[model samples]
Target: MSTFDEKLKLFAVDLYKINAIKFGEYKTKVGLITPVYCDLRVIVSYPQLLNTLAELIIEYIKKMQTFDIVCGVPYTALPIATVVSVKNSIPMVMRRKEAKDYGTKKLIEGQFKEGDNCLIVEDVVTSGSSILETVKDLKNSGIKCSDAIVLLNREQGGEKLLSENGIKMHALLSLTQLMQFLKEANCVNESVVEKVKIYLQNTQVDPNVLIKNNRLKLSFLERLNFAKNPVTRRLLQVMCDKKTTLCVAADVTSTTDLLNLAEQTGPHICLFKTHIDIVEDFHPNFLKHLKEIAERHNFIIFEDRKFADIGNTVQLQYSKSMYQISSWANLVTAHSVMGKGILEGIQQSEGLKDRGVFLLAEASCAGSLTDQSYVDATLKLAKQYPDLITGIVCQNPLLLEEPGVIQLTPGVHLESVGDRLAQQYNSPETVVLEKGADVAVVGRAITKSADPAAEAVKYKEVLWAAYEKRIASQ
Candidate 1:
């Protein structure tokens, strides 16, 4: 009998020989473009490799627990489960991706009692969605499933997600192990290995960190892991590191006042929103100083330019005008009323590196024009430009159907009910905790306070406290 290492080496050799493991640009099920692809289904055509894989999985599972029946996830793992069951003399059950329309309508096939313990088998695990779906089905049928075994673990939060749901995960080979074997065997080049390593590091999602610091729901984190927008990710990272989801709306008119507000509130905010065009003393030096303060305090400059115009006009307004808003602002606001062309225009800006846009879905002012139809259209347009649109500026959180997009609630104040200008307000607890807002945009509450810096700290603490409470309740 060969050692586990010896068997794994031979299996890797066979995998490359049959072209089951290919090196190229392949998009994963979670929408990540990976450098290497592992098609486990190809193993079925090679009987020797299939048997070796079953042996490896059975050996790996031996350390876990003994179960009454083994259930394969679906189309791909059924054959592998059959091989494992026959060779080990273990009873096997099968789960249908979709039950038959007419006969019996049973989702699970084979003989199993209500209290039987079933082990889930899978070809590969990425986000563990398939395994979770299979577990849901088995649980509904009153069968116990406390363990799952997979041929390959992509190391992309699958283990953490499964463990959170009370199921232990066992894998025969992880992506790191396979990469190391391939590199040692000279099957893949150094560049391929490096690319895979980089991708894994960049895309790896830690549910614990996200929940602990960011206070984001697990379901939201799963989608956020696959988001293509770098700026969106950066915003979330800044919020976590700063421990604040407060965006201070600097509604002042002079550069001095704006810069003062920024300096005072910068340490307590993830974003310093501005209306640069509205600055009475706007100049090149103002932006330079503002950017310096932003970098010093680890906050992003958000230009609240609710651009609503044709593509050509907006493009010039964003990049070419005297303001040149794209040169410093990390994020900008836009109205989807103009349609996809607005996004295309923003994308055409020359200095638009690592920038994102938030679409105006609803307003907090009295008698605002943003209706349900307008919000639906805005979200629909935002979806078409996922890489550009990172969030929706709204009064409520209902517009957030996609977990990848965040919600920013404006007009948040601690005590003010309604301003003379018809600006309504909500408390930090109400917006961040009850409304599920990612960032509570507070304008007058912080900007108009006597001690702006002290006021900023108050709002930050309240917002973060509410966020922690919300996640704890969840």
Candidate 2:
């Protein structure tokens, strides 16, 4: 199979080639004249393309853990849903637009009976009213309807409406994404995208969530004052804003590799974390390029300095060093051994208020010195400097509930054991989901992949899925 992105782009391109999505005033099923119309019912003409659609829906069903049986909304989605159910051997069902008057004389079609989990599949969601009708029929039959899948979400309050009716709406693409792909492929221009945006903005159920991907990015100080920890807030905010919760730890020894990785995969990450002192042949030019990558990619620059000195000395190290860390980093890591004095010292630096710091609540080294007492004291110390502290580099999720304290767990890998030197490692699932870390800091696992960008994409999917499950449980 192709990469997830390639599949979506290809699906849309093939659909456009067939003139499935046409631009012109047309009457919708609901009786509204619209400038554009999507007729996915065209898939019936191409079995090969229809098979791909089934495979894509199956991919999402497996990833999302959505349904045991698939049901089509009795129109364009019927063929795809039928193909998916039969091909995958999943039970298929549907509520007809009208009850049959002939043999069987039934409103519901399919062998599925009552009390089965049904997933509603549809071509598009404009207002979500049609799917709700299917849900109503399913509920009448005592069958549960908990999820709906769509090829395209119109971004017209349909998702919010479905969610309100106790169904999770999963779409392969949204209007905003479709616009982006079209513009990138030169299929449409900026003016056309702007017009589509205007149409979508008027159909929002929650305008706040739709305005810029449901995020309100805060400045360093604003993040501090947030109800959650600044680091947690930052991580979640980035995930919501950029649709990813993966951060790359540029652990390479060469500045060349570091910049290349950032430039190539920057858009998929929430932050580019670096140990500036370790990069070979590092210079002001290195920092300049690194800063540029972060700016262009919309990710934060995190210097993993792990400062352990007294506040006064650490302050100088953060600012006056040959590298001049304070000039570029949006955040840094520090150890909390000296209590409030460590934070007080760092905060004393000029222009430091707009930057944030993550305390070393615990380390990943096996049997290292940071214990429960240390973590508790660190939490206490952090509260005293709420304005300056963002979160902690924690192995344990002890500080999660403390207001505004985000836990960022390191030592994550796709596969690996402890290093010969005694450093431990955990999978992204272990650290992000099991330990409740807001962000997963990964290094060689991704950077060393045969294809780093594809590897990063895989990590993002798993991490974001786990994050969604955690949020639902909460």
TM of each candidate vs. truth: 0.55, 0.52
CA lDDT, every model vs. true structure: 0.83, 0.75
lDDT of 1 by residue, 160-215 (tens): 88899888898878998888888888888788888888888988756554343332
Candidate 1, TM-score vs. the true structure? 0.55
Residue-wise C-alpha lDDT for candidate 2, range 133-181, written one tens digit per residue: 6887677677888889999987767888788779899999887887787
Against the hidden true structure, what lDDT does model 2 obtain? Answer: 0.75
Q: Which candidate leads in lDDT?
A: 1
